[model samples]
Target: MSEQQKGPAGGGPGGQRPGGPAPGNFGFGPGRGGPGAMGMPVQKAKDFKGTLRRLTGYLRPYRFSLLIVILTAVLSTVFSIVGPKIMGKATTKLFEGLMGKIKGTPGAKIDFHYIWEILAVLGILYIISALFSYIQQYVMAGVAQKTVYGLRKDVNEKLARLPLKFFDSRTHGEILSRAVNDVDNISGTLQQSLTQIITSVVTLIGVVVMMLTISPLMTLISIVTLPLSFVAIKMIAKRSQLYFKGQQKALGELNGHVEEMYTGHNIVKAFGHERKSVDKFNSVNEELYQSGWRAQFVSGMIMPIMGFIGNIGYVLVSVAGGILVLHKTITIGDVQAFISYSRQFTMPITQTAQIANILQSTVASAERIFELLDEKEEVPEAATPIAVVQKESEAVPGKAIKARGDVSFNHVQFRYKEDTSLIEDMDIHVHSGQTIAIVGPTGAGKTTLINLLMRFYEINNGSITIDGVGITQLKRGDLRNLFGMVLQDTWLFNGTIRDNIAYGRTGATEEEVVAAARAAYADHFIRTLPEGYDTVLNEEASNISQGQKQLLTIARAILANPTILILDEATSSVDTRTEIHIQRAMNELMQGRTSFVIAHRLSTIRDADLILVMNHGTVIEQGTHEELLAAGGFYADLYESQFSSRKRQVDAV
Candidate 1:
């Protein structure tokens, strides 16, 4: 690939991680920079209200659940308030009753009936508080899970719609992290944190009201620390967001490293690059360690600080309330009630202050997930793409659509990126049943040509047509449905052999799948497996060989029975015996179909009716194998270089 195609920074040899630069990147894991890789900012919380408002839409479908959760929170808070009030009232009644009893008089003469009535009311409040709290916790959990489920589905669908280039630009792990860890953080913390907020506010309100009723002067002095605690809480939250964001980024990096290592471990072993990879990994691991410590350190400070302020509030209320009791500003029971109210009010404040970090981090996570969902797909079809229906006679086994299989590249031009053209001003035509071979060196646009033909990438400045009708005019899926491709990277999903063979023809009978496998010479090894056709093979189709894998892919294509077939580097990764078997299978599969072969194996395509030699985005030579050799052009030169080099090596041996 050219530098222009690669860009200044991309997935070449030196593409950095998502946020860039590991901790020790120079001759080690990172460079002069320490563990601050994501460059996280501790800015004041951005328009959190706006973010909260956006989140409410996720609750629309589960409005009833949301309603129940809200009601529970309110009810739970009311119970919390009643608990302290009940104790205070009963304490007062007990004190008065004791005084009457001490005078050797009937406790009822002092209207103990009123005190008993108040005590009964307190007992009733306690039951209500416990019941509401239990139900409220259950409902909020359901609400959070429901929101997260919908969000996950939305994110997944968005991922499917995005073009292949997006996957190339980002790591698999980063995308997976965005879907999982980030979403989990957003949802898991939401229910608890939101409930805490409600409880805190309610308790504060109830306590303040009760305290004022008893002694307003004492109440005012008690709440002096409340505002300061809130300010400190807010400051800690601001700091916590940076830490959480960094921590999340570090996790993504760690996951990405694991995925890369696992996927490419073979390459590491083969090239003896394991040591370098290990060193890089350890460096990333250590950086995560430091980042994690910092994030936890900041987030953990809120609770203790809020607790300290609550303690101060407690001391002030006690000193002031005692004085009020001594001076008869309030009765002993009233002083007791005021002290209970002060604790209630200050306690929730501390809890809310503690959970503030969880709330902010969730908001940040939601914003990130929304960002991905908001991405625009690269190739969107027209509102109504004209469809091409096939006749019953021409239709493939499972496909209902078919074209004439007559392909034409009309002044065709294509480029992986805009700066370089892989194919330009190319024109070619093939009948319904003809074979063409494309031969080229590395970087000769052979793969790009196939990509254009398959419509994986768009062509520029020209059009490709099937049966004189533009392919773009047809439905995208229908256009692709006419052909089958055997790519260099053969991806076999986790399933039984029969399922993989009949993957394209989903409703095909077992017999048809078996027939296709037999034609590809894959039946022998497949039947030898423990399960035969039912033998499961994701990556561990161990009883079979690489040749068998190639054959199986071919069998799948044959079962698909496409009118057009593309054999792109199909024989590139197998031994000589496997190549011969695959080549034979391919010839059988290609029969009576317009077939295109992209090959480095010149010998295989020697019988092709038309051979095109390509170089640097253009066809350098075109003719039959013999005709091209006689012309003595680029094709001839490539052929001579290959066979002659082989002959010289053999002679030396």
Candidate 2:
């Protein structure tokens, strides 16, 4: 039977036997920040100006629209600012009329006609102000959406071009938070905050000017609290900045925990480790809650504190304006105007203070988005690419050169980290149409060879060539097109079975897909499904059995029809009967091709052209299975232990 079909020592797929690793330690360890870790670390942008400048580059295309928005915002704020002064004129006229009537004066009657005229002007100004506000909001919305759309597109493209190492070193949830959460934060700031800044500044200047026109003494009194307001905001905002950073980091860690737990929920339940998973999640969740509330509480304090300072300024202005009126140095209308201006002036100050706190959080989010956009991409393609021409009949119309699958790795050296070598001084040669099997213990450099051959990771030293031409001379896309790979982990998207199979070759015919499935022994089960080839798989393809999924992947590789094939533990996760069928299918697929097979089951590769036994990052033995057995080296020992153990089991059965 395939090793995956049986748990260790003939147990079920749940691995419920006594000696299996605990579920909590399935794929995590102390080094991975196990359950007790605090939170995910955040990457803060060191160069804020550089990041902002690059972000604005995306906004360059909408400069004319932004200019219109600015003009409309100024117009609206100016109209709104002047309305109070006009209303103050009407108040003064009414007050004079009242005083004249009380004294029984003939020409002191209230100017009702003039009062109506002032009211009409005030209404007109308000209507114009509202109209401009609407126009500015409408225009700015389009600008913000377009700018963020461009940013999102750039980020998505950058993800496709990043190196494999970048993904290997980070979790999926961490990357997703940057893509989704951080980007949305930037969008909100752009849509709302930018125009608010323009309006607040303009209103503040206009209110101060109007206040001065009535009485400079009252205006001076109103602004005495300005310095105090600034001091409070500065102190509070510095502390708020730290909390905002913590909140963002905690959110990322929480997301990572959720993603990992849900993905492995089945194993957690099977092994009765639900409590452990929940406890780990609670630790991360508690951290997030603490940071989130602290950030909100600090930011929330700004508005009320600014309002208190503004109220103090209002009381002082009111008392001073009344004394000036009593002295007959200013009209009642002027005092009323001064008080109205005082309130208007302070409103904008409160708004600006609130915006400052929001701006800090926005900068934190933008820094994250910029960090992702600035990640290192894959190595550049060669200036001149060498094309692969596999068969004489398949030659291009004008290209004279041809490529065959004769691979050679000469003295290749590689290490994941600088201090630890994974492979060193490795040399191998495979003639065209040869099947080379790789055998090794766990942690040996089995898959590392495939990574180098595919150029997923460049070797530290030495050269790997195909058809006597170095792979580095060819474009990555052109080189990858020459081989098809099927790993142990099957990846099937949420789509119809037919679509998944056709993913191998673009625009493949229905007949070709069916033929490939039939050869891989997957056609029988596909037909038995309710929708046959039209069956739509769920997310993660959980609707199908593991063995069935492996068959479908094999069918896909067959349809690709590459000149070289790579199968890494391909048949390890199936039943014994299914493994036999898969072996027969693989033999057919590997015909007339240079194939590399990495397998743990020694019996499966007994007929291979060559077997390479690897240990400690170097090949210790190399020969045919029978020749290695006769020599009694490392390969012989591995083969004897596995087969002898299996023989005893069969005899007992």
Candidate 3:
């Protein structure tokens, strides 16, 4: 019989004229670089270097902590680096003692005490290294968490400030991915990868220095193998990167499909689309499997190829050191240390390569976050806004102004886009406590009128006034507080029934909440539930029936006690009996408050003081129900058609 629509309203249909876009078509367009293109899209940062520079701003506050982490990482690497060379001394000592014993030299017995001393020094060095590593890790974790905390806070605040239009064109899932997953990526990198990079670089440098001290020729041989390692990594990475991109794109598509199917499963079942949904899922899944498999296989080649090249260098170094030892050019201890340093050298290079890839991914995540933050925010509110305060009887001096129920729209014009005309030269005036009912066909600008009154979308021209003061001059919060709205599509969050009702008014007393529920004819049914007022609704509020949910929303609006009431098919969900009871209660509630009732059922609004018949975002007729009937106009025909249909139905029965 009636329908209530809510959320961001846009300009007229097809950019023709007046009323803006239809209500509740919060669509998801391929935004910016969103993946609707033909290829497997790689999720790379649009501005990698610029994003990194911007990312440093988040870390700037933790600069001192980062500096300490760097110093400790260096210390940890230095201590760990010195251990191999020192242990080589013990190795050389043991080797020399064995050689001396075989040669029958005097004092040829192994020096166990000297070896023990070297082991003790080595143990102390390792313990200190571990301690420094632990300290750096602990400090870095705090810095990382705190940095992300600030980032998440900024994102949350930004979401609040964003206009309804921003949400209208985007999916909830896409926005959430940027907010949750992307931020988590940045946090992980800051916590672990950042410190690892520092340690790896320091170790790489220390190993190079140590190797040079041992044998320049061996170091040269080891260094020469690095080019081969680079070549292998570059080739594998280049090939695997495409597959990685494909894998990511497939994964994203799979996730989006799952989210859609799960949320709309009831609709899918109603339409017997289960097989089709499964087929779609399987197709995406197979694509993901192929790409993921190829990516992993190609990426897996890097380590083995690098290892093979490294072994070749190791063999070359070993042979060169052996010849040098025969000539007494370098001690065997130096050869042992050099070998250890060489292994150490390759590890850091490998680690640095891995971290480089991670850094790219992290910067991409940061860029997504920055893109969200950079979106245009809602227009700024009026400066020196008029306060909507309580009005005293007899015009008390120095008291603030209070809003009366009078509302007037003077020659208003609006469009969702500048090129189209949705609402053109629309004018209406309502006195205090008048019950105005809007009757119209679909896309008739019925909801748009309510939206403009609520200031959900700003009008392009003319002015709307309440109590002789411009609505734009009033604080948005204050202006909105003047009206109470109840829609056909009821919304309730996961909370106790009492809490949901009390949401209409902050700090409301328990008695007031119960009284409002009673007025809405919801108290009796609510008390029958297991937990009564304390009953918790699920996320979708599917635990309760539709009519009961509508009743709860009605109760909420009643509790708000706003100056003006806007009921858009508020009683559409209830049964005939419940609707009668609610209508009686609403009559009592609207006694002195201005009310705007939008409905398609002509019979329900017969007693309204004023009825506006609308079509295509413009008012076609305006009069009381009886006045319109006597005039034999558009409203008269609409009213006659409803009764005629009902009469025919009764005759058929």
C-alpha RMSD by candidate, in order: 6.8, 7.8, 6.5
Please give the RMSD of candidate 1 to the true structure.
Answer: 6.8
lDDT of each: 0.72, 0.78, 0.80
lDDT of 3 by residue, 1-653 (tens): 01112242422112112111111101232111111111222346789999999999999999999999999999999999999899989988898899999999998988889999999999999999999999999999999999999999999999877766676677665677677767876887788789989999999989999998888889999999998888887777788768867776776678778878998999999999999999999999999899878877777777778779988988999999999989999888888888888888888887776666667767888898999999988667788875554423233455567656898989899887889888888889999999999998888899888888877778899999987778888776777777777777677777999998898888899999999999888899999999999999997789998878878877887888888888888677789977887787677667788899999788899999899898877888898988999999888888889899999999999
| Order of the predicted models by lDDT, top scorer first | 3, 2, 1
Comparing 1 and 2 on TM-score, the stronger one:
2
Q: How does model 2 score by TM-score?
A: 0.82
Residue 169's lDDT within candidate 2 is 74
The sequence of per-residue lDDT tens digits that candidate 1 reaches over residues 451-559 is 6775666677788888777877776666666778776656565688888788756688978888999998899988788888888885544446677888988998888
Q: Over 4 Å off in model 2, which ranges? A: 1-45, 60-63, 98-104, 107-113, 227-261, 271-305, 369-375, 388-393, 400-403, 417-421, 648-653
Candidate with best lDDT: 3
lDDT of 2 at 438: 96
Question: With candidate 2 superimposed using the best TM-score fit, by how many Å does residue 572's alpha carbon deviate from the native?
Answer: 1.6
Candidate 1 residue spans exceeding 4 A from truth: 1-54, 60-68, 102-120, 126-150, 227-305, 350-356, 385-402, 415-422, 538-544
Give per-residue lDDT, candidate 1, residue 413. 80
- Sorted by TM-score (best first), the order is 3, 2, 1
